[model samples]
Target chain A: MSPLLTFFLWSLLKCVVVTVVLLIGVAYTVLLERKLVGRIQNRWGPNRVGPFGLLQPLVDGAKLFLKEELIPGNVYKPLFLIAPIIALGCALISISVVPFGGPFTIWGSPNLFQISDVNFGLLVILGITSIGIYGIALAGWSSNNKFSLLGALRSSAQMISYELALGLSLVGVGMRAGSLNLRVIIESQTSNKGLLSWNIFGGMQFFAFFLYLMAAYAETNRSPFDLPEAESELVAGYHTEYSSMKFAMFFMAEYANMITVGCVATMLFLGGWTSPFGNLVPMPHNTFLLGLVQAFGPIMWFVIKVFSFLFLYVWVRGTLPRFRYDQLMGFGWRVLLPLTILNIVGSSLWFAYHS
Target chain B: MLLIIFILFAGLCLAGAINLLLQTHPINSALSLIVVMVSLAVLYLTLGAEFLAAAQVIVYAGAIMVLFTFVVMLLNAGKEERTLGSFASWSVGFPAVAVILAVIASVLIKSQGLGTVHLSDKITSTQELSAMLFKELVLPFEVTSVLVLIAILGAVALARRGDGERKGGQ
Candidate 1:
């Protein structure tokens, strides 16, 4: 095959594989949240579907597929139909630049374990996320329901406010790594000192990480910051008018966003795909297992770090009470935003001194 | 291939601009404006300004347009009513626009030694762009930022004055 054709084919294959895996990961993250929240609340969650509810996400997908879709009479038809699609599409696209593992040769071409490794990967993610707010805002507006409109407005406002802090927090990391490319940032963290060199530890970005954590939870509309969708106030929030697959799309989008946030946090702060032990853990030299370990080991480490972040997400959701609207706004603007700015200045000063 | 992509985006950009003008509903018009902004970003990308393309999307289509939509949505602005031709718009607007276009077209046609863009895969990296902005053009950059700050403060002051008038009347 021609090299260009090989490149095109491999890229197409990688896109398909990564998207499928990410969707499945989204499904299982929902399951993980349910199971963990269940355990926290002293109950077993979805245990009957398969062994330990392994088949639950599949069953849930089928159930949502089989459910009847409803279209309200008063909706703005064009935007109503387009809203969920925009939501899901933006969620899926942000993962294209995330590197899951190191590069490997295939079809005489070396391919990184990503759909595309853009130079401005981090900024692309941020830009996509900013655009994602439109999905919620339009869904609410098109529905013509007052409750849905309120929910959408609140959600968009919250996301926009938190995005400033979130972006600023990562500025410190970008400065430390001296690149916005995700892979280069990870490589910068790789040293013999292992975990110490990671941004949250030795890089003195611990405070920025906390700010990012809070801002990210708000960005994704996760619990404790989920004032927009408070069931007692707004029926089901921005997705109130949606049903069946449309509703399912919004649900999937939310979980996918959670997973993406986890992936980004893993890449930026926790040292993406790199083993915490650094070179202390030796790779096996046996020929057959060597390739296996080399390819899968980084992936394993990446998965573990992301899983822990997800666990933290669920843990906080179960523990903390939801913030009031005013409190949420106040916290993001007054507290987190300033702290992130301070973090940026401090990181820049530290880097200057060291250099 | 690059020419084809550029043509496609440029066409989309023109289409979106026309749509923005034609759409009656505020929300639809706002969305069409977003499309215009995004296609312009793609055009910038084709010209190898990758960072500029991203910033255009993030700052214009994403942030500024969202605020525009928020205002329209909050005010519950309905579809615009059709109106008879306005005298000033028909007489002044068309001629002014035509004059500007004529000037631009004549410049393009008459100018010799004007450079043509050679489409290549090379990108202007963010580091180089930042270095140029911060080192060579630092004064202008800082001045532009301060100007924007002044505009924001002026807006705030005007809004505060409105609140003060309302309170005094009460």
Candidate 2:
């Protein structure tokens, strides 16, 4: 095959694999969310679905598939239909640039674990994820319902406001690493000092990481920042009029965003896929499996880190009460924004001094 | 390759402008604006500023345009007003004449150049463009902050109710 054809086919295959894996991940994330929330609330969550409720997400999927899709008469038909697809599509597109693991040797040529390694990978992810907000806004507007419109407006403002903090918070990470490439950032974390050399504790990088986590939660519209979907005020927020698989798409998009944020946090702060103590303790010389183990090290570390963040997401959802709209906005614009700027200035000053 | 993409992008831009003009509904006009924004982003990509292109799409198309569309929807601005007598004709005629003149000037300029400027693919790629933006175009980059400030002042002025007009308030 020609190189172009090979590249095309490789990208296509990677898309399929990532889509399947993400779909499964989205499914289980809901289960994990519920199970974790249940434990926090002192209740058994979906125990009867399968062994340890492993099949609950499957059951939930079937139910959503079977549910009736209602298109209200007042809606702008075309836009209403297209909104969810756009949301899901943008959400999924971001994963392509993310390196899940280091390069794997494929058919004699070295194949990178990611679908594509664009030079502006981080910016692309940010761009696509930002675009995902339109789906929610459009859905609410197209529904032609009062509550939905209000929810959509709130969401649009909230997202734009918080996104400033979210983007700024990562500036320090980009600055310190002196590279935008995700793999390069990850590789920088590994050294003889082990994971302590990771960006989280790499001098003043922790402030940026903390700001990033907070802004990330708000960006993903998780608890305390989920006014867009505030049940008491706006019925079901943007997707109030939606049902069936259409509704499921919004849910999946949220979880997918969670995963994306988790992955980014891991890549930026937690040394990506690098083993914590593995760097400190050198391996025995010249073992075949040692190479294999080291090869898979980052991927394993990345997965574990991502899952831990996901759990933190659930824990926050369970523990914290939702923020009122005023509080949410106040925190975003007043608190987070200033802190992010401070973090940036501090990081820049620290870098200047150190370098 | 860059020229081909640019040509396609220009066509999309024209289509989007036409849609904005011809489409009766405000919502459709908003959607067309998004199409225009996205096309501009493609143009940015062809010029090689991938980061700026992405930022353009995300900030303008994704965030700002959504706000515009939401406001349009809130205002329920689809109703057509009956055309005022000769004012409508003047509105259509003057803009058309100006556009025609602008097009003629552009075509004349293109013909005068005689295709001396061979559009290099390397010059239009993202890395090259970004280097140009941050290094060579730094002044214009800083000037954009002034432009944004002007826009802010313009918006505030437009939104403020006149003191003289308040005398007639109920």
- Which candidate's DockQ is highest? 1
Question: Each candidate: what lDDT?
Answer: 0.91, 0.84
Off by over 4 Å in 1: B102-116, B166-170
Candidate 2, lDDT over the whole model = 0.84
Clashing pairs in 1: none
Interface RMSD, in order shown = 0.8, 2.2
- Model 1 accuracy (lDDT, Cα): 0.91
Local accuracy of candidate 2 as per-residue lDDT tens digits, B1-170:
67898899989998999998788778888889888998999887776666778789878987788778768867767745545459877999989999999998899887864644443533343456668889999999889989999999988786675644676684
Docking class of 1: medium
